[model samples]
Target chain A: MTDRPTIQRILTGISGFDDIAVGGLPASRSTLVSGTTGSGKTLFALEFLARGISGFDQPGVFITFDERPGDLRVNARSLGFDIARWEAEGRWMFVDASLEAGEQTPTVGTYDLGALTARIAHAVRQIGARRVSLDSLGSVFTRFADQDLVRRELYRLAGMLDSLEITSVITTERDADYNGVTRQGVEEFVFDNVVILRHVIRGERRHRTVEIVKFRGATHRTGEWLFTIDPEDGLVVIPVAFLAPRDRASSERVSTGNTELDAMVGGGVFRDAVVLLIGSHGGGKTLAALQFADAAYRAGERCLFHAFDETRGQLGRNAAGWGLDLDVMEASGLLRVAATYSEVASVEDHFLRIRRDIADFAPARLVIDGISALERRATPRTLLDFVIALGGVVREREITTLFTSAPTARGTSPIMEIAGITDVTLVLRHIEGPGTVRRAIAVMQTRGSAHDRAIREVAIDDTGMHVGDPYPGILRLLPDAPVPPSDREE
Target chain B: MEDQPPAALTPMATYAFRMYVAGRSRRSQAAEENLRALCDFYLPGCHEIEIVDATEQPALAEEERILATPIVIRKSPLPGYRVIGDLSDRSRAAFLLGLPDSGRPSPEGQRL
Candidate 1:
């Protein structure tokens, strides 16, 4: 048996792209990036060059066919890329192929793109560029009426780039989101690698995803992965499955803020555990979350508390009503409260914002008070993915996190789909007593440890939550459903 | 190569042409020949042609934003026109270049 030479790869420096690409794009080869209009194809192409220059110290050439170099410079500046500076430093070059206004070039007979190829080669040699990005081949197809000639010339151009040992990205446009690979059928065939960017409207919100169709003589993760275009950071592919597998389990316990509830959960939850608190409205779920945050603050650990259903003032007032001072904690620099309505942004945006907050604050403990409010804006599957992706983030850092959710009217919770991922599950329900209503709490499941199986009565007073003795003979704990009558009265 | 025209030809208005091509390839040579033939029969002794090899002077090609090879630019006159590819069809190329047909030879007698 003969051993084949392994193909070398060059890192694209795009966040999360390298992870999904396994290593990066196959080195010294051209990859075609195809997308529909408004699918961020230009942004992707620009970032590939920008990141190569900024992150890897590798010079690049950007051959623009759709947008002018000045427009691209201004557009790239929004993403914090100093393309003009890079150009001045001899690290970046632009081959302006975009048509000028009022410019007309009438074709008379046979012609080839030899001049363009010469100009690209000149720029590449001038800058000693290792990377090249040609934005939107669709413009070239539109400019040249002869498709066969354009395709043949582009294939030759790719070969020229290959001989120069330059890794290149050529972007093309797609007519539809899920149609064929590109507008011209020959584009994909001309390149060795193909990547598709999709911007689809799901549930009335725009969702962007990237899928690697093929990488010749190489391996990559298949299927569509979610990505977001940030105004400040450019393109960021969300690699949900790329999270490092965490096997570092902490046996150390941490309080859930209230000591009595801690005792019910067998000396508190694991230090790196992800605890989910499920309850109905006015069932003291937020109170438990607030207590969790307060405990982390008192323990001298920074905590990030995000509330989706309430404003900051509302949260402060609610905390004050429970005799907990949120302002003092905020001033102490150990607690940061971020409050926003769930409808303000899409679920993916929310995830990005929270991820940014975590990165900035480096909080040891994180709490999301009302995740169910986000459920209204996203589908059930998206909601579950959000939690899983969020879990991937916090678990990698071993940050103790808590999420509170309200059961749906259907009596099933979206978080139930991710039950195995959670280390601790806490359920709170409202009990209908004789002419009165009382609240009950239970330690449903504590992974790797034994916990109290009894259903106990829970009370929220000015001093906050207090866990009392077990409520008698309550077999069911469905929040919205009618609770069965207790067999034995307390 | 033609020398400077006489002072009387200046009254006819000089026609300046800049042709961009990729090196000394066959298509470029053909384009240069066809352009000289058209200029000789029409503006005869009054036109100036400059052939630029894009491979040797890429900066000039970049300035012109040239893509396809063997393109001719009518740089003189108030309105400039650009025609890409080898000028194989002289009549169509002349029409696109806005050349006056008053002094043109008959189609049957012309052999280009």
Candidate 2:
């Protein structure tokens, strides 16, 4: 390992902190932070160490003389750090030496900062820590009397961290006014970086401000950055450039398999687009997704189909019966069917199982039969998140995906509202007329393209789903006007 | 009491719940009624029964997690249990409840 700091990602697991630090603390070097009591000194250290464990997958050693690790763990949940659990996970090591209340005078190396540093080094070797911290170096100094010795120990410890090439954050309690002046102002000169966190009561509001005093490499805003400690999000560091959130998606669409569905769409669903086919029961919403998969398979594009509502064999047979050519397709390795249920398979586990398939099979088309299938165990929001994340995969690999949803009960608003994210929305309905039930198809809306708004009767026979005529459907309910059938000549 | 998380107190068994169904007029209403009937007649005691009249309390179904009338749910017995279907079918209500193998089977021999 080199003695110099590496150009590495800071890996602060704290959600907002990494972004605020513009991706994280400088690796392979120590940063000194000094603050008074209740000024959020310990919180910053805890956040750094805990986040290193969870986010960067780094092990951590916290050397302390102030309080028991138990107290720290309990206190940390409010800051979103389960210190004890991290210790249990073997990612955290606590070196503790507590003082009994009212203990008497001691000076000059009463606390072993050097021995604690060795233990921290040992834990780092054990857990392979890329980061470490010493809670309140001043605590050790509190009991020691030799100023020269303290200075030497402090210099040696910071140099050791630098030599080992490990990123470190060492906290020191300032004497109320020494936010700028360190103990001899010596620790500030020795450490590679110095960050000061202070509490400022401005006008009636108690505010927290963080300022990076010195970092060896790269520049940061000179003005103090404002922040808050929320119970859920932990330490939230406000980024200087956060007003413009990133727009992660480009306009796109995917295929629905059926030509009528395609005609309902402009040509095909946009690449990397998430399309939702929603319809009432027997309205062939699931069939519509299958129709898309079949067309993709026929066109030499492999498709991965996850049928949560039906069996894989049964789905294949059904498609074959409906003239979608499943047998030849599956034999040709153009189609993969996974008939899974959320009961036996958890939503996340199921996603994990198919994550490889999405990566390995790299299908030109992917169908989650109905995203609603996973929405049982997976909430609509989570399901939407998964779809959105998967959309990135589609964008990277240039693939299309189709999701089916049982229309939100007959009259309730659409349950599967994947519409907002789709390049196209196809609506299916079973319109009962002339003592006969007819499957109807309509292009409700297609973003960025002109689509047919006419409601047409849809059918699936020995051939496939056929869209022919506009019927007096949800789009047409006026009396004295007759709607045409799919097979009828107008 | 099986030594689980506090949140686990939220009902683990969403089955055997009740659905209040009165009648069906519109497609939404019919879907809700069909769902309720399917859940009730299929799941039986696994679900509790509560059929209210829309005519009596037309405003009852309004302003809920649901907007339409003829909605149904498993009474407030379990934590985090949901209210679903203004008027749905037996298949969905049955599947939602995770009814026993003895309960309604799909006409196509499909067990949801």
Candidate 3:
């Protein structure tokens, strides 16, 4: 790559957003903020202005339509912004054109935004503002019957702000039926940069995502990066860089917390490899993962156990019964256990929480006790995208991760899907014969090693686990044993 | 212009009008002229007219919620009124200003 002059950026101060933007926004330019109602477009704009004023020493003006400046101040306060103080201190200016539609408003002739432009110019001058947000342009532009006139006015407004050297964020309402970023499609044409906010509903949950549709002079990460509006933090962007690729591969390996099981996978799992342990409910998947946790802790490495199906306390006690001493590891700060139900938060929020934990803990070994429970929280496609994102995050950090999931009767589940992307796969199942039941584990696939193929009877006890030799003879009495008769016919 | 407040005008005019106009636009200039003529004929010496150039003073326009150009507003007389466009039609302009039908001159051509 050749050296290129870097485009100057104004840091938005929103968490994780700068990473996806490769920095903040391009300075002294307009960025279009488009989304349907309740998708947090207004909040995004407010947060940008608030952050600019408070954090970057950049004063701003908020020109609004349909919402009064007083009400906006109140709403912003509820979101933990003290815009009222900023306005009082003359660091901010709010120009409201929301009530301009009624008869009380001054009526003017066709294609005249002279008054609006003058008011904005006066506000920018009053505060010497570096940032400006008009939330929104749709309500204002909808007053026009002429599309061409609206387009011209929008271009003129952008140019006006550009001439003042103020970087502005102009919000435009997006309709559910409309295809373009803005309601009129004029915003995208006028502004050099556009950012789209989407609220995707899965079941009863709304997953909020932000995507930069276009950035004129910069190369941006092209994907929908996740974001959530915190009542206190305002807008938090989950950067795509968390999943960006690593420069070089590491050949290090870590134990699975069991000597016999480690040997079965040819001297334990490789560093940075994602291992999937597929099993039915209560098929010793958690126990196998705990063994890996124990090994990691014993190696003096940090471990993070993110549990979806069980409580952290329950996991601690369960590991204690196996003599793994997870409680002691946690007490020593060698291990951290966090548990949350998937239904409590949207899939994106849950990912953010997990990402936060990973960032704070910086664990070398990570284990998600159950991914199937997370899958239950979202649609198949949503879950797939989330898992892919999660996989990317861990893979980039070169963190060895173990995820457990229950297999369907057809051997299909999130585990099966993740197994393809992961480096190793371990399938665990219950073997039933007449009136007896036994647990068996088979190494389906393992990267960087010659893994065992034979299914083995895995025994778990207080001392740990024992991997018994090949149980091929016992498969005759089990259902779907050794590929069954259908496989032979096919 | 300020010294001569239009001959035959009374000091206690009941009706008050403010016409908002952009700079030298043909439509705005027509609206301003039409508004002055309408007031001169209808209210005669009983009304007051104030012409505000929106281009020169946009902050006032924004404060008044001006969306378009060449708009006439009747600020007094209890409920305010707004008229969009050039205000060239006499009857429509009369209706917007809440003028009585008899406010117009007869065929004999009465002057203010």
Candidate 4:
């Protein structure tokens, strides 16, 4: 049992998004996605369908309960998603029941959803679809008086979809404030996966985020991820960067080219443990992660690190000056560096892919350099589970986990739960001390063990992660939420 | 919070009237009686009357630019002609909106 740790495999066919989803959606079963109108549920489902056909070569169909086939096709076409064209090509089938589908037909009494459910099944089989979407089922309960009817139809509907071997997304209209509690209680339990799309109002601005609440057969990152739907680009996701897992840090404990850095991390980080290095932007989080990797490699230890917030090419090119030759390490299998953009993934995909890498090489040390990236793809809860599960692996297999967490400068600290639940929560803050301000490190909390709690100043020169007593002029790294671009709007 | 007077009246310009007052204040009752007599005397079938009280429709009062004990702003439906006072003189009220009053205000005024 002391053998190497293994990575889990899951694939979701969407591009850019899959990058944030980690590798991709896990293969097989169903995932529930609940959101309000215009929150991009159908778009997300369509993108999944498009990817299923184009990337995975799986024929899929989309059955709409709200919009008509003609309208759905036209809407999809405007976004370069020509559903009708795909239908003609035999890759997708678009089915819309305008009257029964849309709630436009108001009634004083209840309605029947059996015909609609049967129609969805028939549509799924008609096109030989391996993937399908209900588009919506909020109005499904409009007919059934007893809540059990809604539960039963959803269960049978999901069962039918599963029997067809379809990895599908069933979207429902959910409240803006998501509290992990589901309204369609039984339906959520029936599905193998649940993704909650939430529109959050931070300060005065509204942000759309997606979180995977439950993935029964697999481990998923459950965190709120900021997402956007561009007419031309579809759903674009950007994940906050934080400590990454799956990639191990070097235990060689190389000096932070800067001597002070060595003392800050206690003669460098220990081997095979989850070390969370946190700070604000430009607070040297990335540089610190790099310095440790460089130190270990120079010490003749194999280092495998994957940075999700950046690309492999960009990271290598940027840090070339520090005598950190990522290109060489990658070729030698001594350093496996990969940079992934969150817009390319949902957190579930991210966890799955990282799980994959962890399995493949079974590195003695794995570092998810910035965990914030996965937060964009998952709900906070799923992200927590993903991290807990990751910690379990790190402890059981003895793989050192070192990653960076960059905090925001706002009252709302969304990443707190994730940071709090981690094994080690360190803060690289810029604080004012002795009349001057500079970078500092505070050991917030490290469970199961005790370490330095007092904060001390840290500096970076030619090397990285230097520690010293308090400095007067430098600023303290205050926690804040990263603002989105749309926030600039008046 | 007092009621406003009947606004100016005109053939082209609307006999726009707003009954502004406090929560059934004394001034409000006086304004209401004055407006009825004034409207009954002249300028018929060419006015828009809106009854507003600060204790009730405060938003409307602000929008109509009412800010005194009893004020009325009768405006020309065509351009920028207005009057803010009691509509006791039929000719003066009509003249404020650049119109000559023919007779008493019409209960069924044509909507502009």
Candidate 5:
């Protein structure tokens, strides 16, 4: 670590926010949070104070200029913040500067917001507050006619807060999503740090992101990071790509649930490996996933199976056809099959739900069947982010995960992008013979270990998947024609 | 223009006004001076002025939702109206506070 005098920070305690903020807002300094309407600017401002009071025992004063204290109190209840109780406990205070409905105050000549500044100082002193939030300063700008005067008074207010050694969040509104920093175009210049929240409609879905524009003598992660407003947890930023790679790579092997597939992958896959199963509709991807889950149950370990392409009933019927009793495994508490339509929610919500399930069940193995079905609901970039984030979660817990996807028509499939992050990849395809369409399987990559490099025929009977002898002269027929050197020896 | 006041005002009606200020600042003093002059010229003996220093009485200012300093609230004579800023423009301030117009014919031929 450099011995430079880095600016001190106060942890906001917002989920996944501190990771990107490099700690939190600069200590005892004001930061501007600007956003468009309904872009969660108020929520960010409220959470900054709520979390400070609850998580850090820091009292705060909320100076609301647009919303009343009662509305804020009621709205905060949905996010598990008891503002009334905090008020009763002398930890939270509100300086109600919100204008009454239809009650306009006409200006005569010249004035200053000294009354607001005095009330704010009084509230801060009453509660001994160390944190203050002035939400949506745009209302003040709209209330007054002179922009320069308002800007000057707000600048003085910020200076006073600094002298009080109070860390503050002053929110402002932006007219458009990607315009200047604020609606007034001067609010950002008054503060040392600035954060912007954006809500963009992409492909008929709302994608929320937060970015740290500048920190002024401080360091922070630069970019737009995805976030979702959870009712129970408030605004949760999804810092997926920023997660540090897991340092400990487990070398112990775990079975792939199929004897032939295990032999093909040099005995088995690593214990904490993320495996990708790529195939067509009828190429036995679901069967491999089911067998993998069954093997985990047989080993007395818990498994979570999430299905997007099939319903639970259909999956149960398919498992019965393969002579595996899914109900019995579920009854034994070793297997859980959760099936849902991918279009029911955004990919980020699905990710949060899966994360919640993993935390609740603590499974040792996970199987996500038909991730490509989710691709229909999200853009390729979001889908790749989902996979990367999911990879980070499973690998952190050392839970072996298997993700199945149907091959895309184009050369650059979303699955191909995911393959780069997965520890193992298995490709299945239907090879056309002279009179019959036969299935073949190939182990494309195994991160640490390797074994057979042959195109082997795979057959499925009433019993289950069965691996047969190697299929010769099949390299040229495959798409992309990736001819392995071992085929020459044969 | 007729110099007659609007029929709504009665000579016996007492007008009550409360002004919020920030201590003895220059703007607050200017507002006080302008307000006294306006009241003396319009409703001389019928006006009651109560001055509140918001810096010393923040809770009262908060209760009144006072954001800017040197604001005057017309408390009585029904229908309360709030006017912000230091009241230097006596004619406009008189009109906004619903005071009886001064019998002075000026620009725009309107009674001040």
Candidate 6:
């Protein structure tokens, strides 16, 4: 490690991003930012320069080949960044080199960015800038038919900025392939770092994700990070630490609210353990989990309940039927309820919301009313990662949490496979008796302790939930109920 | 840098020229003189010339899309035209300036 050269970094000032980048961007080198149109590429580049001047006191220059400087100033102003003031203060410079549409100019045999180079050098010297950005040089590539010339000129420009010791960022358009990081493919070769931004529309929602494709000479987080562009905060890269394992383990056990259920799981779940309640609709999963949160709150411990499947008013009304006044609990500040429709936010954004609520409320116990709603919004693979990440974040704070999930339509409980990750996995399902159906609960696995293997009958009333003794007779149980007969074959 | 009002501002004869230069360099002086001589001969006293010294106003280069020094832009008369290098060559300058060669003959017209 001592032999490795020291890698100085420049802070991007984006919240949660520096933690993943380990300490902001690598210093004094070119970084290529590739994204599709309207993916907030220009806004990102401008924000970096703007924050560098305002937050880090690093003067900068912005050379745009796509937008006029005046228009850029107006746009920045609307975003609450006073770029015009920065220009007047000699801390920033905007160079516009955009050619209008249908405007043609004659080009000689071989030419370089001689004029652009002079303007940039002058701006740099004028402000003693430490950062520079070329909004887009994609149009410049069209001026030449030969790719080799474009490549050569790009290297020359890179060398010039290197000599000036300014950390430069060049934005470019992504190719149609979607797999390729940049349009020309030569930019990644020339720059020391490359970041790819993607805007994907999934189920009528737009999701923006960014991935660091290349960071030469250093290790970077390997996963694609979710990012959001707020008018005030610009680009915020979600930290990868959400997946990091935390050294938080406790042998202290807590109650499950239902006496019979607590007795089945040896006494209670261990602190910091994630309990997943797998069930289908009308299986009383949310009611059972809310009983735990209500019990924890009644015991004077703070609890946070995230309702993804139901609104606050609906959840409160449902809980009120069982004499659990969620509204009163929330008013007392002992129970904090966060509600949102799963479809309203991307999975990653929803994860951040949970993390934020956890940080702000500092709850000792938590419940995600319906985790399966998240699984429906994202791919199975992505949902698995999200579950693991959420578990990590919760366990790190030693928050005893319960997650409710419904098995798939095929009666397969996906969360059951990850039983080893959770401290307790209690599966709830319906069993068909002689001409009748009954709800049942089974404690699948309990880490660090023994649990009863017998499946017991469960019943929910207006008063509360009741769990009976284990059934001794032959059980005709299903992991989850089969689909309803609305379209069943005749 | 000089700005001259058009003699008539007509839809056709009222020409508009925007010249991008770099200070008092020989190239800049040559471009200015060549443009003046051509306008004096072709559409004599019927054109407008606006010289922008990029060395003083670097932003003007970007505003005008001036990629090279001693560049000229025929901004008016509907469609515009742009060209690099000092505007010294007669035929090339006329072609870039969109000045039809069927005008009144002059001393410089003989060379073209």
DockQ of each: 0.76, 0.00, 0.28, 0.01, 0.70, 0.22
Model 1 lDDT tens row, A206-259: 789899998888888888878888877678776553244566778889999999
Ranking by TM-score: 1, 5, 3, 6, 2, 4
Count of backbone clashes, every candidate in sequence: 0, 23, 8, 93, 1, 0
The C-alpha stretches of model 1 lying farther than 4 A from their native spots are A1-5, A239-242, A247-253, A260-272, A409-413, A431-461, A467-490, B1-12, B100-106
lDDT (10s digit) by residue, model 6, range A230-295 = 654567665444444455569898888988898999998888888988887888987997899987
Docking class of 2: incorrect
TM-score of chain B of each: 0.83, 0.44, 0.75, 0.54, 0.82, 0.77
On residues A351-422, what C-alpha lDDT tens digit does candidate 5 reach at each position?
A: 889988999999999999998888777776677778877887888888999999887433335667688788
Candidate 4 segments whose C-alpha is farther than 4 A from its true place:
A1-10, A14-31, A69-85, A99-123, A140-156, A175-193, A202-205, A211-490, B1-112
| Residue-wise C-alpha lDDT for candidate 5, range B1-112, written one tens digit per residue | 3897654667557899999998899999999988888888788799999999999999999888899989999998768878998888887788789877544433674332
Better of 3 and 4 by lDDT: 3
| lDDT (0 to 1) per candidate | 0.85, 0.61, 0.75, 0.59, 0.86, 0.75
Top candidate on lDDT is 5
Q: Quote the positional error of residue A66 for candidate 4 in Å.
A: 1.8
Write candidate 4's Cα lDDT for B1-112 as tens digits.
Answer: 1586545333444555655554565555555555555554554565666666554554454344332323444443444443333344434454444445433353455321
Candidate 5 docking category? medium
- Which pairs clash (backbone N, Cα, C closer than 3 Å) in model 3? A66-A98, A106-B64, A106-B65, A106-B66, A108-B68, A108-B69, A109-B68, A109-B69
> Where does candidate 2 chain B have its weakest 10-residue lDDT segment?
B61-70
lDDT at position A71, candidate 6: 88
How many Å off is the CA of A326 in candidate 6? 1.8
Chain A structural similarity (TM-score) per candidate?
A: 0.88, 0.55, 0.76, 0.50, 0.89, 0.76
Query: What is the DockQ score, from 0 to 1, of model 3?
Result: 0.28
